[model samples]
Target: MVNNILPFDDSDLTKMITRQINRSWNFSSKVEDKLSTELKDLIRQMLEPDANKRPTITKVLRHPWLRDTSGVTGISLTAKTSNVVGKKK
Candidate 1:
C-alpha cells in the first residue's frame, strides 16, 4: 500500500532484502506520518519476524483497528471449522 504512494526504488531491493533477513526493517517516514497509530501498530505486529510472537489470524481479527464493533464479530466460526476439518488426518 505504501508502494502506491511512495514507490520503492529497484536499487533498494537488495538493502530491503538484507534488512528483512536481519529483522531490522525500517518503514518509510511517509507511511508513519500518513497512517493511523492503530494501523501502524497492527502492521508492526503482523510484520514480527518471530512466528511465535506474531499475531495469529484470529488475534489479528480481534485487533481494535480491524474489529467490527457493530454487533459483528470479525472472525467467522465457519472458517475455524473448515480449518479444523482440513487438518483431520
Candidate 2:
C-alpha cells in the first residue's frame, strides 16, 4: 500500500513564505546599524504575492546594501601574489 500526503494549502504556504521573508528582515532589523525605512518597505513590497507592488531589481540595487557595499563586502585578508593585488583572495 502507498500513502500520499496532500501538499500544503495556500494559506499555509503563504504563511511559510512570509515567515521566511520576514526572517531575513527581522535579522537585519536587529543590527545596530542604519537600516532605512525605505529598505524595510521595499522588502515588504518585494515579498508581496501581487507583483504590482514589487520593486524592480534596479530599485532594489539602489538600496544601501548595494549602493554602499564597503561595509558588507566580505574581502578576505590574506597575502597572495597575483597580477591583481588588491582583489579579495
Candidate 3:
C-alpha cells in the first residue's frame, strides 16, 4: 500500500515474475509523497539481498516505524469501540 502499486508490477505475468526475482524494487518519484523515513529505512533493510543482513522478525516488529504508531493511529481503538457500543445501545 506504500505507493498503491505492487513490487515489480507489470502487465506480463512472466516479466513481473522475472523482475521480482532478478531486480531491486524501486519507485518513480524523486521522493516518496506519503511514506516516513523510518518506514523507508525499514523496508530497505528488509529488502536486503543478503539474508544475514536482514533484520530478524523480532527486530522488524520492534522497529520504530511499527512500534511508534501514534502518528498513524490518530483515534485510539478504545474510543472507536466505545462509539460503536453507544450506537448499538
> Which candidate leads the pack in TM-score?
3
lDDT per residue (tens digit) for residues 1-89 in model 1: 85244223447898766665566755677566777677778877887767899998767767877653456667665566557555746
What digit string (tens of lDDT, one per residue) describes model 3 on residues 1-89?
67556666678988776765565677546447577889888888776656888897657766788767575757554445556555743
Q: In model 2, which regions exceed 4 Å deviation?
A: 1-11, 14-39, 70-89
lDDT of 2: 0.47
RMSD of each: 5.1, 12.9, 8.1
Best by lDDT: 3
Question: Ten consecutive residues with minimal summed lDDT in candidate 2?
Answer: 1-10
Off by over 4 Å in 1: 2-18, 68-89
Tens-place lDDT digits, model 2, residues 1-89: 01122112246777766665454334232342455555556556656655665766656655554455456456422212223443567
Ranking, TM-score, top scorer first:
3, 1, 2
Q: Model 3, residue 87: what's the lDDT?
A: 70
Candidate number with the higher TM-score (1 or 3) = 3
**Model 3, which residues run further than 4 Å from truth?**
9-23, 28-31, 71-89
Window of ten residues with lowest summed lDDT in model 1:
2-11
lDDT of each: 0.66, 0.47, 0.69
